[model samples]
Target chain A: MDTRILLGAFIVYSLSTFFYLLNLTSERKNSYGRIAHFLLLSAFIIHIMSVVARYFIAGYTPITNSHEALSFFSLCIAGFFLYVKKIYKVEILGAVILPVVLVILIFATAMPSDIRPLPPVLNSYWLPIHTIFSFIGNAIFLVSFFISITYLIVEKGLKEKRFSFSIMRFPSLEVLDSINYRCMSYGFIFLTIGIITGSIWASNAWGAYWSWDPKETWSLITWIIYAVLIHNRMAIGWRGRKTAYMMILGFFSMLVMFFGVNFLLGGLHSYM
Target chain B: MSDIQLLAFGFNHTTAPVEVREKLYVSEEEIPSFLQELKDTCIRELVFLYTCNRMEVYICADDREKAMESLYRVFCNRFKIRPEYLSNYTYTLEDKEVFRHLFLVASGLDSMVIGEPQILGQVKDAYRIATTFNCTGFYLDKIFHKTFNVAKRIRTETKIGYNPVSISSMAVELSKKIFGDLKRKKILVIGAGEMCEIALRHFQKEGIADISVTNRTFANAKRLAEEIIGTPYPFEDIPLLLTEVDMVLSSTGASRPIIDKPLITTVMKKRKNKPLFLIDIAVPRDIEPDVNNIENVYLYDIDDLKDLSQKHLSDRMKEAEKAKKIIEEEVEKLSRAINQVDVAPLISHIVEKFEATRENELKKYIVKLKNVDDDTLKTIDILTRGIVNKLIHPYIAMIKENGNPAVLETMKKIFRFGEDDEEKLDNRKQGE
Candidate 1:
């Protein structure tokens, strides 16, 4: 995928987030909504093509070799969220999270277009599988992002005596919580697979199955947050604002693994 | 005023215990028979809404006194409650009063919880059951449909169900009552339906985190399973899931009893009889009727929704009343407009005739002799038409006054009622 095309898709998604957020007080019209859905579909397809084009240029999948995979995962997260929001008729949900997706994709586009292939140790079938699952896992955390936004706004609306017209466009609190669990549950599974695949590839490359690397530790931390959320939801009846808050905090750990681990903390997962 | 008849009766948490509510439940099985009893009433439109909190029957009749007597006696006979229990609690709404009551009830104003949305669904279900028995008539159908639409308008235009604790949120409250602390419990959902998702989501939010899922299909079950990190087991895995899980919510669409007698009994023996709260939300019933017999087994079928709905209503009384007022005001405005539509056309016609004559006089002077061409003659005709409108506009407007008080009163009443007949009559008179 051309970095420019991927950048363009990010811009389109970012604008949609703006338009949908502007729609909060504005009258909701199906005509514009239908247009919004088509635009997002177009953007998702374009985004996929961008990733494919980049792979063709890179000679091997861009999923390996660190920097590209992390950036690609964020765009994947945006595309998945936009698709899910449209399916459920909760398009406003995209308004809260797509901005983050746009920023991550923009950052990915700003990096060097390409030059290096994976090290002889980096080439493996598990690398692509691991990357795909890990991206999918992070996409679920994005869903939690949207739901937490809705829970807060709805609470404020109800508490004030006047229901915000913008809140009307959002899903019910029950539906919001449901979406969060759905995201966290899927994200958990994907992360588990990601860890397993990373371990297997690491052993193949360096003769070890387990290493307490920064990226690995951070991924584990993300996994624990989701585990607590699921446990709270099933056993203790922990949901609503508290669960939403935890989901967000967990996503932050994921954020650290992405940007902070690479540029700020400079871990093995980081690339020059 | 004709001898219009009205009867308003309901059984809610305020009036009836859960045992009595279960007895008078008028289940999906009983709805068919209840409508059969109402078939012979002189009532034009009949609505039967049964919830754990209340069973309300609103009948529209010209002879309000007789209709109330007949409807009240049926309730007295069915529940075996005495007449003393009837007049004191039962409310009667005849003619216009019936219209207001239906609107109020549909809007959730008359409910103990004033703004709850469940009554609309319950009312729809009751109407559907009545239709199955071929009991609802023209008047009831129109009125109830109108009532529902008005309720919809109030919901959309205002914030009726937005405040206080909602019924779904309170479902968690019921869970807390059973388990004391939610964090220690495990929830197993039997199906992948919306309610199961909602209940699972709620339990997840509450902090009771261990969860398992057993659905009809393994793939959907696995998918939801992968997301939640719960074991996605097959249907045969249910008995095992139930014993280990503290709460089980079954919302599957099964033809016969899916959770039959032998399955629940064997399952209960596994966990030394841990408190099993089973919410059977399915219509045909996913759990066996005999499942209720097991010790420490609290089985709540759809009948319990009415009570749950009632508890929510009491918690939301103020909002319900506000929503009801909005619906009633809307109905009143509609009735007044319906009344005017009948009389307005009669006034429009007499004015049209006066305008036509004035045009002829003005055109004779615009000179029929002027260019003797089609284009020139058309322009002259338009000029004369304007003159006619200016000349006859006042006289036509005064016909609505008609110099008669009786005519005015009749039109006022017709518009107040918003009957379709009056509008048709004006259309007929205008045609002639």
Candidate 2:
């Protein structure tokens, strides 16, 4: 039943993506964005219900496998996207971000979602705390990645004086840039907490406070990139196209940390 | 026959020069008495659509030639123009052409700038004024009401009036795209000339509150600032103002470029790289073209703005074709409606056919009767008359209510009204 409900969420997200695409392509201004927004809100609610049901079935937080982690990642993205939408009039941004979420959900559904015994290495309170914080941080950066690309497209159009219909309803360069900044600050805080909680969990599981695992090393690199972005933006006035480029770079680094280390490197965090 | 002729006469931008139109233009204050004078001349239902581009008078009158002559005399006497010269500049349309012309005008298809929206509002005001003066009757009222509907229909069905094409409005649109809300945004106006003042007013309408005016001459800046309730800055304060304002609009008569790359580069550093929008409408280009290459700076010279405007104008032109097609369809529908109004022949033909049938059938029944009495014959005649009138009443009501053309044609066919008779009805309806 939980898997069925999750499938229901995937379908709703697809419907929401269809409406956002329609809102983007059409020139006439109407309520397509508003309809897409409502659809996304309902999809998020159904997604939360599925996750809660999964917890009741498994008797633990569902972050121990690739299926659970990817599902949780997509859920965090949808949640953060909704929060960003409430703060900004970036309805067109959904056209780009919702497809990414849908793709992640597809990969998640492809993986095994059966109830399994919890591995001894993952049985701790830090399992949920570390994974939840890290997924939310990655989700925030994911939204910023699309926003950065939108900022670049609009900024280029303005510089070239080529006003096309695709980017016609996009938020301004300032608005996109400001959203990137907000994401950078909040994502950095969540990432710091995730890293700290992981190290403390490492002390309990592996009997060490610090270990140079591939995921840890890559996360450090991602953290450094965003730290530089925040510092330069506040102190040296790095903004507009420059800030958009940095956000794209930081998001790529985060991808390597979240997926590459687990899938290829076979680190201690390989359960995810 | 209704005997009411629809007439339209006007001086428009196409037919008359600006000087001639200005001379003949009637202000709103003068319209009531002008209408009364036409009323005294035996012209009843009329609406005077007065706008800067065109001044057309639509009238429903009993005498076409006399109405035209009276209108010319009113133009000559009211504006002190000679009759021959006025006749040379004005064009007149009648009946079907008048309906088509008013639809085109109301829908902005006939505007000087095709698909411009203000003409619709002006047309509405004209109809409202005529109604207030108690001038419009059923015919005029019906046409004007349909005119408004046509205008609204065209607006929704096409993208003709979607984008802003004028230079000042395009600037405001771009500003909104850059800054989501213009409220509390500061604008620095260079030169304080008429062009700058007009563009500034456009921005002000968008809620840009903090406006600073600067010019080469301090007094001119002060005067313009006072006029618009803005702060005046000196010419030497250009760099200082650059760091403070979000947008800069420059239009001056200087031969060389005024604001350049290095000045803005230093200003951007001082302002910590806040985004700056610069519009240079000057001939020699008040801002250097190279300044656009700078980071966090967006510069659009006059040529770029004009190019965007030209694109929008072409978009409107493409949509105008669609709008014209809609108007043609509406005109055809309205033509059918007017023809239905003049369906007196059809009504009479149906009654005569039924009467002949009733008389023939009654004669046959009477011949079969043995020793028929006068009272019995009267009762039979009354019964046949009652049946004929009752059968025809609903069909007559449907035709009078302007039934759909297909249904009306089916009724005509059921009555055996021939194709030749239909041609005669149309000919008489067209008054041709």
Candidate 3:
């Protein structure tokens, strides 16, 4: 039943993604955008229900497996997107980000979703806090990555003195850049806390605070990239195309940290 | 009533030069007397829109030729222009053409700048003033309301107003692209030239109040600064001000480059590589071309602004076609609404005629049944009225669906509802 609810949420997300894409090509009328926002909100609510149901059924945190973790990650991204859209009035961002959420949800569906008893090493009080903060942080980074991509496209269009449909749909580069900076800063702080909590959990479970685990190394690398971006933006006032490139790179490293570490590196964190 | 006609008469930028339009321009204070004079001349409903680029009067009048003659005399007397000169510039439209023309005007499609937004507001103001003076009757009120709706629809449904086309506006747009918000951004005007002042005014409209003015002559800078409510800085302070300001608008009378690469590079260092937007609108260029090569300086000369403005203008022109389509659709809708209104009186007339005949027949029968009680008579009256209403329902539906003038006329003639009765109905409807 929880899986069915998750599937329903996935369908709604795909619809929202399609509507947002349709809105970009539509005439200046905002009905398509309004519909997309409504669908996204519905999807987010259903996703929450599914997560809650999974938690109730499993009698522990639902993010004990790759399937649940990836689903939760997509849910956090959609939730953050709705929050930012409410504050920033950047509906156009959904046109770029909803597809990314849909892809993550699709990848989650591809993984095994069967409820499994927690592995002996996975049972812990710190699981919820560590995983929730990390997923939320990763979700925020995903938004920044999408916004940075939009910024680069719009900036390139302006520089080349060309106007395309996608460029016209983008928010101004200044708005995109400011939102990118905000997302990066918030993402960095949360990721820092997430890593610290994870290390604390590691020490309690494995008698070490620091581990050379592949996920840990990649997460650190991702955190450093965003740290540089934030520092450069605030202290040195670095912005525009260079910052956009950094955000894209940071998001890639985060992807490697989440997926590559699990599938290829096979470290102490491989169970996730 | 037969003579009443919708008429739109105007001399716009296409038909008249600035000199002619200036002569015919009526100030706001003069509107009451002008509307009174127009009313006295048999213009039953009227609105006059006076903008810098166009002077127009839309009217519903009883005698078209006499109304035009009186309007011509008013124009000749008020502006002191000769009748022949006025006639050469004046163009007139009638009936459906009047509606089409007014819709085009209200939607900014008839603007000199092509999709400029000011004309719609001017048109609305004219309608409001006419309404205040009791010069706008039912037809004018209905059409003006429809016109405003059409304008709003065009504005929302098309990209006509999406881009800025003027050079100064384009400069402001470029600054927004760089700075995001101009509210707290400082602007430095490098010269007291008209173009520089114009660009500053554009920035002022964006709520940027921190403006510093400097010129080759300190006195000129001070005067311009006082005029624009900005602080006047010394010409020698350009380097220091350059590091502080987010944008510099330069349009000096210099024959060669006044700001060069080395100078801005030093300023960039002082400002720690922050973005600087330099708009050099001078002929020989106040800022050197190579200054754009500096780390964070974006330089755009007059040609670049003009190019951007031209591109935007063409884009608006393309959007204008879409706007025209919207206007066309709205015009059709409005015409259908008008026809629906026209059918209302016809339906009422048919019902009234049938009831009158029914009353007459009932009166004739009352004498034959002299002993009939009041209650029975009331029931009989209700029954006859219901029958008449049921008999007219199909005809009313038919008339509403196919409001063909010839068929309506034939129906009215057959029922002895003459044109005079139609006029009375119209007057009664207007009174209500």
Candidate 4:
């Protein structure tokens, strides 16, 4: 039943992504964005149901396996996206962000989701705290990454005196830049707390506060990149193309930390 | 009484020069008395639309020639122009042509600047004034209502009014395209000239609050700033102030370029490479042409703005064709409705006559018969009613389907449906 709900959410999210893509290519119309928003909200509700159902059945938060973790990451992204959309009224952001959610969901559905008893090593309250904060932070960064990408495209088009569909569809550079900064700052704070919680949990579970595991190292790397970006933006007024480039780099590092560390590096964090 | 005819006579920018239109222009204070005078004339119903570009009168009357003559006499008397002089500039239309002309005018197709939107508002104002003066009857009321609907339909269904033709509005549109919202953006106006003031007014209409005005002559800039509720800054402070503003509108009388690429590039550095939109509408270009090549700067001169507005005007002209098609369709629909009204009484009269005769004969027979049951009486009544309906259905259908004037006239003459009776029926319908 949980898988069915997750699959339902996946299908709806795919449809929502299709609509957002259509909105991106077509002449500016509010109807396409409205439909996409409705579908995205529906998918978010079903996804919450799936996660809550798994939490009830398995007797723990549902971030145990790679499948569950990736799914939760995508869910957080959708949640943050809907929140930003409500607050900012930037409907065109979906064109850049929804496809990323779709890809994550597709990868998540491909992974296995089976009921597993909690291992003694994983039986701690800190598990949920660490994963939840980390995933939320990652989701926020994902949004910033896409917004930064759109900003770069629009900025380039304006600079070159060539107005394309993308240039016409996206919001102004100032708006996009402000949203990117907001996401980066919020994501930075969440990741800081997440890293702190993970260290505390590591000490409690493994008798160490720091590990040289690939996931741990890559998370640190992503953190450093964002730290530099936020610092430069706030202190030195680093903005426009440079900040946008840093956001893209930070998001890629996060992708590697989330997926590569589990599949290729086989670290102690591989269980997730 | 003769058949009421729809009549429209007008002088527009195209038909007459401004001097002739000025001669017939009606002030707002004079409209009520003018309408009273028109009501005293042969026109039973009338609406006078007076605007800067046109002076038109739409009337409903029993005799078109008499109404026209009276209107010509009134124009001569009111404006003190001879009938011969007025005749040289005035054009007249009647019936369906009148409807087509009014629809075209309401939809902005007949505007001096094609597809301009203010004429629709002026038409609505004329309608309201006519209503207030009790100069509108059913025919004029229906036409104005239909006109408003056609105007709204054209505005929505076609792109007739989508583009801005004026230079000031075009500048505002360009700024909106760049900034998304002008409310938060800061604008600096250089050289308090007429064009700059007009563009500032457009920006004000767009709800822009943050504005600064600068000029070589500080007193003029201060006066313009006070008028537009903007802060006045000295001209030499523009380059320093440029770092804080998102857009610059310059219409100064300068022989040399007031803004250059190096100046904007330095400002861009201070702004951290944020975009800047510069509009140089001065005749002798206020901003350097090479400023457009600078990064994060979009500069448009007066000629460029004119070209953009011209392009938009051409786009509206293309959409005007679609708007005309909509008006044509609406005119046809309105004509059909009017025709339905014309023939409705005749059809109803024929049906009423047949039913009354059938009822009279049935009543006489019922009295002659004895001990008639209720069911039998009902059956007899239904049978007679059915036969009468069947006999009259073809004629009613024919009159309604064709609604040809000749057929209506022939039927009216044959049945001796007097004009007084038709007038009574129309009034009765209006009361209902």
lDDT of 4 by residue, B1-432 (tens): 127788899889998998887777788899889888877567889999988988889999988888988888788999988898998998998777788999999989999788888999999999999998889999999999999999988887787877677888878866765677888889999998887888899999999999999999999999999999999999889888899999999988889988988888888878877778998888899899888877667788877777767777788889999988898898889888998887777777777667666766776678899998999999998899889888988777777777466777777776556556776466445433
True C-alpha contacts between chains kept, each model in order: 0.00, 0.58, 0.33, 0.14
Calculate the i-RMS of every candidate, to one decimal place: 12.5, 1.7, 2.9, 3.5
The true-versus-predicted C-alpha distance at residue A264 of model 4, in Å, is 4.1
Better of 1 and 4 by TM-score: 4
In candidate 2, the residue pairs with backbone N, CA or C atoms under 3 Å apart (3 or more residues apart, or in different chains) clash, namely none
Question: Which segments of candidate 1 are over 4 A away from where they belong?
Answer: A1-4, A11-42, A57-60, A63-70, A78-103, A106-257, A267-269, B1-102, B116-145, B156-169, B172-329, B348-392, B395-432
Chain B only: TM-score of model 4: 0.87
The full ranking of all candidates by TM-score, starting with the best, is 2, 4, 3, 1
Model 3 ranges off by over 4 Å: A26-35, A163-168, B293-296, B332-432
Task: Sort the predicted structures by DockQ, highest score first.
Answer: 2, 3, 4, 1
The CA lDDT at B410 in model 2 is: 75
Worst 10-residue lDDT window, candidate 4 chain B = B423-432
Q: What does DockQ come to for candidate 2?
A: 0.58
| Cα RMSD for predicted model 1 | 13.6
- Cα TM-score of candidate 2: 0.89
For this target, which candidate reaches the highest DockQ against the unseen true structure?
2
lDDT of each: 0.67, 0.87, 0.84, 0.85
Give the B-chain TM-score of model 1. 0.47
Off by over 4 Å in 2: B40-44, B341-432
lDDT of 3 by residue, B1-35 (tens): 12357789888899998877776778778888987
What TM-score do all the candidates reach, one by one?
A: 0.48, 0.89, 0.86, 0.87
For residues A88-115, what per-residue lDDT tens digits would candidate 3 score against the true structure? Answer: 7888778889999999999898999999
